[model samples]
Target: MDGTREMKDSKQLISNIQAQYPRLSKGQKLIAQYILSNYDKVAFMTACKLGETVGVSESTVVRFANALGYSGYPKLQDALQELIKNRLTTVQRVEMANEYSDDTTILNKVLKSDIDNIRGTLEEVDEKAFEEASNKLLNARKIYILGMRSSFTVAQYLGFYLDIILDSVHIIRMDMGDAFEQIVRINENDVVVAISFPRYSKKSFEVVSYAKEKGAHVISLTDSIFAPVASIADNVLLVKSNMASFVDSLVPALSISNALIISVGMKEKEEIKEHFDDLEKIWKMYSVYE
Candidate 1:
C-alpha cells in the first residue's frame, strides 16, 4: 500500500474494524467490540489489560492488531489514541474518569491531564496561523461569532470583549429560530470566528459552511485538523481539550481567545481608549460602579 494511503487507512480505525469485522475470529471479534465501544480506555490500555478486559489471552490482543494491518499491538494502540484525541464524547470521557476513580490521587491526575493538554496545545500551535487570525479580526468590516452547546460560552466571551473595541460584532445565537438568517448579510468584507470542541455541534458546521458560501473569511478554533470546521476555515487555531471527566477543558481555548482579543485591542489602542473613556463617563454618571 502507498504510504499516504496507509496513513489515511490507519486514521480510520473504526471504519477499518467494521469492514474487517465479518472475517475476524470469535476472540478477535470480542476484542473489536470492546475497542469500538470503549476506545477512550483502550487507547491508554496495555495489551495485557485489554485482553483481560475482553476475556481473551494477552497473545490474542497482539494477533488482533496484526489482523488489522498494524506491525504490532503498540502501532494499533497509537492509531486508536490518534482517533480519539479530539473526537471523544463526554460519555467516553466520563468512562475514562471512572477508570481513575479508585486511585487515591484522582484529583491530581485529572489536573495533570489538563496541564498536559495546555502544554501540548502551546507546543503545537502555528505562529503564522495565529497572526493571520488576529489580523483578519482586526481588519474585517464586520465580525460574527458562532458556537453552540459547550462552545457557546467561549464564543460569548470572545464577542463580549471584541464588542467593546470593535464595531459591528455579532454573536449568532442558535435559539434565534433560523441561525443562518443571522448571517445572510455576511459578505467578503466580514469575518466569522467559529469555536467547536469534541462531539462538535452540527449547527456550528452549518454556520461555517454558510459563511464560506457568502465569501466571508472564517477563523476556526477547534481541537484538531480533523475537525469539520478546520477543513473549511481560512484560519484554524488548534487547542487541545482532552480531559479526565465528562467535561471538556476550556483553559487552552480561553487562552487562545484571550490572545486574539488582546492582539486586536493593541492594534486599535487609540480606538479602544476612546471607547473606554466614554464608557467610564456613563458608569460614573449612572453610579454603576463603586
Candidate 2:
C-alpha cells in the first residue's frame, strides 16, 4: 500500500471557513489566508505570533478559530500540527531513504523512528479521545474497518487482531461498490474505523461518509484534523506520519495500530484469551503451527 492512500481527508474546518466565509472582516481575512497558506507554520505559532504576522489581534485569532468550529486558538493550532505531521515533503522522503542506506541502518532507523513516533503520539494523542474510541470498538455490536492501499494494512491488521481479541470485526478491502454494500448493514450498533493519511484516498473518504450517514460510529486514524474523515468521526486518532517525499513512513502508523490492538485486548482480556485458545485449536487442526 502506498503512503498517500492513508490520508483520510482535509478536515480543517477553520481554513475551509476562511475560504467560504461569506462576510469576513479584513482582519479575519488576513488571519484566514495566513492559516490556510501556512498551516504548518501556524501549528507552531503562538496566537501573538500569528497575529503579528497577520496583523490581527490575538482575540481575533481566537475568534477565527471559533468561527471555523474549533473551541479556540489552541484547537486551531493543534489541528495545524496534526495536518503537518501527516503531510510529507519531497526533501524529507529523500532524507529518510538516504538515512536507510543499509539493512542495519534501515532496521535501526525504522525501529527508532517507530519508537519516536509512539512517544510523540502519546504526547499529542488525547487520552479521553482514545478511551472513547476504545470503548466504541469494545462495545459495538459490529466493527467495520475501511482502509485503502497502504492504509489497508493498518485496517486489516486492526480487524484481524481485534477478531482475535474481541468479536465481530470485519475488514472491508473490496472496491467501493462492495464497501457500500457492506456499509448498508451498519447501524447505530456498528462502528467504522477509517484509516487514511496524506494524499488521502477518495474511496476511503467516501466510505467513511457513507458509514456516518448510516449512523455507525466512526473511529478515524489519519494525519490531519483537516482530513475529510475527521469531521465525520465520532473519535479521531491523529497519527503522525512524517514523510520525506511522496512516500510516507509507516512505522508510526503501525505503532498506533499495535497500541490500539493492545488496548482493545486489555479491555477484553478474558474474551481474547478464550478466542486465542479456540484459534490455537484451529491452527493445530490445520497443522499450521509455525
Candidate 3:
C-alpha cells in the first residue's frame, strides 16, 4: 500500500488487530496475543525471532501482516513502534528495566542509549524547521511555553531564559489550576512552544490543539513526527529520548532547547545585552548575590 493508505488504515494498529481478532486463524491469534502483550519487545524483534517466540513460522507472521492489510511484517512492526513511541508508561518502563539482569552494566547501557539518541536526533532534525522555529520566537509578539510531567523541566528551563531576554514570555503552569484560562488571551500574534515526550499528557496535546485553533504558531519539541503534537505544530523539532531504563533521557531534549534559546538570543544580541545590564543593576541594588 502507498504511504497515505498505510497511514489511514493503520491509524490505530492495536484497534485494528482487535477488530480482526475473530477472523484470525489459531496461529495468527497466537502472534496477535504476543504482540499485544509485549509490543515493546516485538517492535524490535525480527520476524525469525518473533516466530520463535510465538511458535509460528516466519511465513505465518507475514501472512498475519498481510491479513491486516500491511505490505508485510515490517510494515506492521513499524505501525506497532509508532503506536507505543510516546505512550509507554512508568510501570512499563520499569518492566523494561527488569529485562536487564545483575550482570548487565545498566549505567553504561543508559549512557550509551543517551549518546545514540542525541546522535539520532542530530541526524534526523530538519535544519529548515529549526531555523523557522527560532525565527518565529524571535518575531512573535508574545511566547507561551507548555509542558507537563517530565517535559515540564524542559519547558521551564527554556521559559526562564526566554523571560530574561524577551518581552511577554509566559510559562503555562498547571499548578495555577486554569492553564486554558491563561492561554485564552493567545491569538495570531503569539507563538506556543510545546514540549512532550513518551506518555505524553492529554492536557498538553489539547492545549496545543487549542492554541493552533486560535491561530497561534506552534513550535513542537517532541520525539518523532508520529507524535500527536507534531500533527498540529507549524514547526517541529525532533528530539530522541529512547532509553533502556524506565526514565526517559532528557539530555538530548535539553540540548535542542539550549540551541534554540541560544539562536534566538544571538538574533537579539543588543536587546539581550540591555536587558541583562538593567537586571544586573537591580541585582546589585537588592544585594541579590555576592
- Order of models, best TM-score first: 1, 3, 2
Quote the positional error of residue 279 for candidate 3 in Å: 2.6
Clashes of each: 0, 18, 1
**Tens digit of per-residue lDDT, candidate 2, span 1-290:** 11122122235454466565667677888887777676655665679978988888999988887666565675566556556655546564354354447789767866665675566577677678888988888899999988888888888877888887776888896854577887778898999999887667888888888888888999999766677898788898877665333466676677778888898889888877787898899999999977
TM-score of 3: 0.75
Give candidate 2 misplaced runs (Cα > 4 Å): 1-112, 175-177
- Regions of model 3 farther than 4 Å from truth: 1-38, 42-80, 99-104
Q: Report the CA-based lDDT of candidate 3 relative to the real structure.
A: 0.86
* Candidate 1 positional error at 36, Å: 8.8
State the lDDT at 143 in candidate 2.
Answer: 93
Model 1, 94-150: lDDT tens per residue? 767666756667777767767877886897677899999999999999999998998
Worst 10 residues of 2 by lDDT: 1-10
Higher-scoring candidate on TM-score, 1 or 2: 1
Ranking by lDDT: 3, 1, 2
Give the lowest summed-lDDT range of ten residues in model 1: 1-10
Task: Report the C-alpha lDDT of model 3 over 11-117, residue by residue, as the tens digit.
Answer: 67889899989999999999999988988878756698899999999999999999898988866866676666656777876776754566557767777778977
For each candidate in turn, the TM-score is: 0.76, 0.65, 0.75
